[model samples]
Target: MTDYFWDFDGTLYDTYRGMVKSFVIACTESGFKVESDQVYKSMRRTSLHQTFAIFLKNVDFKKKQRIVTRYETVEKSEQTNDRPFKGAAEVCKWVIEQNGRNFLVTHRNKSALNMLKRDQFTSLFTGCVTSENNFPRKPNPASLNFLCDQYQVDKDNSFMVGDRALDIEAAHKAGIKGILFDPDDIIFVETVPDKRIKSLLKIIV
Candidate 1:
């Protein structure tokens, strides 16, 4: 069976909206006004640690902590808006029909994961990997390898669907196919059996 590893925040669901509110709350609490789209991109695609580090460097640690705390709370409250993309639910069902396992990967904390569970997507996902789950953040192979082991999926047959470069990096390191999804970079590179996609609807049969 094939294993489908998915990113939750920006890929499977439209979480940028919620993240905007959370980022603003966090940055504002830290006395810094951040650009919403930039912060969302950093959090979802590249390095969240780097983004936070930049913000923290400009402010006192106590205030930074308060900002982080506020973000955690704000994000949890904003979970209601994190709805799945159109036809994504059907895609999940289609993958299952093809004898595939669906894994939800995220850097979100436990509270955020719990919010998804309460929001009705829990049944759609067979397993979830979160920051609270103790795996190193994305661009790291540790978490994806864990999912492979749990689902008994071979790396070569597995595919990760995410809206970030880290997803491709992690998939490549783990010997799985990294199918990147980014509107700006639709140019699919043939090396390592990885390809970049412009839209979820374009995912081929």
Candidate 2:
């Protein structure tokens, strides 16, 4: 069985609304005004810090973190439109049935895992590693190494699936095949799985 590493936001749960809400709250409360479209566009692939600065410019990192932390709580308990993507449950179940371990990796603060716990996603993953209460976030290999050491996941047989270039880069760096999430977003993965698909269902199932 191939061990799987997955991303949380956008990969499984549809937290775009919550993300938008949290970002708006964080930026505005910190100091600046953020237009909805700008925020929306930033959501496509922006890093959390960059996203924060786009709205909460000039804010100290520590204070900015507070804004983001508070917003995370709101997104957790105040879930309005949260949902697992189409066939997410099925894909997860299939992985389990195939005797594969599924790890949820996200740049989201670990506090957001509380939302997953409240939302019942904790039951779905073998392990959920978030950027908050853990090692450096994705695009970085520290977290990935932590996961490998913790789970004894086979790097050769293992794989990563994410919508970001960093995900593939990390997978390659960690010696795992990088299976990109967007079939339409072709990239230069010339030596690995180098495969891209639109849906996790297509790859995992």
- Each prediction's whole-model lDDT (CA): 0.74, 0.72
lDDT tens digits, residue span 103-169, model 1: 9888776754676666676776788888878988877889988988887787778899887777777
Per-residue CA lDDT of model 2 for 1-205, tens digit only, reads 8788887666677676677777777667766678766775566455555676766677788887798788777766646567777766787778788888788778876655776676676777777677665667667777777788898998988877776667777788788877777534543444345677788788753
lDDT of 1 at 181: 69
Ten residues in sequence with the least summed lDDT for candidate 1: 184-193
State the lDDT at 96 in candidate 2. Answer: 80
Model 1 steric clash pairs: none
Error of 2 at 17 (Å): 1.5
- Best-performing candidate as measured by TM-score: 1
RMSD of 2: 3.5
**What's the alpha carbon RMSD for model 1?**
2.8
- Each candidate's number of clashing pairs is 0, 0
- lDDT, residue 132, model 2: 64
